[model samples]
Target chain A: MAAANENITADAIEATEFMELSRKYRVTGVPKTIVNETIEIMGGLPEKMFVRQALEMPEE
Target chain B: MGLLSPQDEATLKNHLSGITIPVQLVLFTQAFGGSESGDVAKQILNEVASLNDKITVVEKNFVLDTEDKAKYKIDKAPAIVILSDGTDTRMRMYGAPTGYEFVGLVEAIIVAGTAVIDLDPETMKWLQAVDKPTHIQVFSTPT
Candidate 1:
């Protein structure tokens, strides 16, 4: 997504290695996703679902 | 000792062979009071960089390179900032790229080197329509 749009930045962080960031974001599970610090998605979802949630678009 | 098996290295090299443009991996690591994963991350990046002539690894001191750290807006140690032909791809990976994380790193590199995003048509439309600044952080553990 970051590559698709220049306005977007994506970061993949290892929970165990970056404990401070994990704690700050309250990440207790693996594959937890935080979008703009406003949206918290737990676990992995399908491509469409993940993209929709990341973009804050209403379900279609 | 090398981390990747011989077969895996061959496969990874094959995957990286199609890159047309240069891909730069800027790594930030703290030499002192940092986790051992910094070394692991460096090794992983070095291994990947060794596969493709177009790929290069640039190391930086997380503590001493304050200017570069701030320029990249990196607040964490053992971070990877991916660049495509000297341009920021806005993709970052923290901690060692192992397990599934390794796959993600390779995919990101491909995107950077090719400037091609392999998203679904509808997803591409949505992503391209994003006018506002979006910051995405994905948290996972090596398993």
Candidate 2:
């Protein structure tokens, strides 16, 4: 997504390596994504579904 | 010892053969008071760079390079900033790129090297339509 738009910046962080951040974000499981520091995705979903949820778009 | 096997190197080299433009991986690592992952990250990046001529690794001191740290808005040690043809891709990796993290790094590199995002058209549209600044942080374990 970051490549698609200049306004988007994506960071892939290792949960184990950044324990403080992981705890701060309440990452209890692997593959947890936090967008804008609010929206939380628990697990990996389909590509479209993941993108929609990450962007906070309404489901169609 | 190198991390990649001979077959892996050949395959990775072939995969990276499509890269026509230069991709620079700017790595920030603290010399002191840093985790051992910094060394791991450096070694991994060097291994990847060795496979492709168009790829280069640029090292930065996380403590000393204050300007660069601020420029990339890096708040932690062992951060990787990917640049495509001297332009910021806004894609970053934190911690050592090992296990599954290495796969993510390779994919990011392909995106940077090819300038192509292999997303669904609809997804691409949505992503391109993003006007506001969006910061996405994905947290995952090595396994």
Candidate 3:
């Protein structure tokens, strides 16, 4: 998503390495995605479904 | 002794052969009072770069390179900023790129080098239509 748009910046963070961030976001599991610090995705989902949830798009 | 075995190198080299443009991996690491993973990150990046001629690793001091740190908005050590032909891709990886993180790094490099995002057409449309600033942070363990 970051590659497709100039306004998007994506960061892949190590949960164990960055304990503070993980704690701040309450990440107890792997593959936790936080978008704009507002939307939280707990685990991996299908590509289209993940993108939809991440973008907050209405489901069709 | 390198972390990647000879066979692994060969496989990675073959995978990286698809890149047509230069891919620069700008790595920031602190020299003192930093985690050992920083050194590991550097070594991993060097090994990855050694496989592909078009890929180069540029090292930066996390403490000393204040300008670059601010420019990339990097707030931590061992952060990797991916650049495609000298242009920022806005893709970053924090901590050591090992295990599954390595795969993600490779994918990001491919996207940056080729300017091709491997997403569904509809997904691409949604991403391209994004108008506001979006900051995405994905957290995962190395294992």
Each model's DockQ score: 0.92, 0.94, 0.94
Residue A58, model 3: lDDT of 89
Weakest ten-residue segment in model 3 chain B by summed lDDT? B110-119
Q: For candidate 3, list the clashing residue pairs, or say none.
A: none
Lowest summed lDDT across 10 adjacent residues in model 1 chain B is found at B112-121
Q: How do all models score by TM-score? A: 0.98, 0.98, 0.99
Tell me the tens digit of each residue's lDDT in model 2 across A1-60. Answer: 899999999999999999999999999998999999999998889999999999999989
Off-target runs (Cα >4 Å) in candidate 2 are none
Candidate 2 chain B: 10-residue stretch with minimal lDDT? B12-21
Candidate 3 wrongly placed segments (more than 4 Å): none
Scored on chain A only, each candidate's TM-score is 0.94, 0.96, 0.95
Candidate 2 docks at the CAPRI level of high
Model 1, DockQ value?
0.92
Which pairs clash inside model 1?
Answer: none
Candidate 2 — which pairs collide? none
lDDT of 2 at B81: 99
Q: Which one wins by TM-score: 1 or 2?
A: 2
